[model samples]
Target: MRVKMRSKHRKAVKFYSTCFGFREPYKVLIDGTFVHHLITQRLLPADEALRDLLSASRVLGS
Candidate 1:
């Protein structure tokens, strides 16, 4: 429900949530708190790969 981040780390944190694999139906928690519910059609390797891709893009700026 709430996302807490320091002022200097705001933009980067937002990108990690929205742009990365943490956005509606896969829920990721922070310190036992809910953040978002990112979803996928299936729970196969492909879907896992998608998450990995998103993470890579954030680091590589793809």
Candidate 2:
């Protein structure tokens, strides 16, 4: 299940990058709720997690 989800996400990223003009160092909008969840889930230092999830070299947060 996890692998499938990862594959799907990768495909989506590829599609967007190819069809559109999306590039690396993807920009992400972080909200309060997301921050709360991260803290509760012990996933602090959000940048690392987002980078891994997005398969990006870097992550620019807003």
Cα RMSD of all models vs. native, in order, equals: 12.0, 2.2
Candidate 1 local distance difference test against the native: 0.39
Task: Please provide, for model 1 over 1-62, each residue's C-alpha lDDT reduced to its tens digit, 9 standing for 90 to 100.
Answer: 12432333455546777777654333322331212223243434444433443332332112
lDDT of 2 at 15: 92
For candidate 2, report its TM-score.
Answer: 0.74
For each candidate, what TM-score against the reference? 0.23, 0.74
lDDT of 2: 0.81
Residues 1-62 of candidate 2 have per-residue lDDT tens digits of 27887788888899999999899878778789989988998876889877766777888766
RMSD of 1: 12.0
Task: Note the Cα lDDT for every prediction shown.
Answer: 0.39, 0.81
After best superposition, candidate 2 residue 14: deviation in angstroms?
1.3
| Candidate with best TM-score | 2
List where candidate 1 sits over 4 angstroms from the true fold.
1-5, 23-62
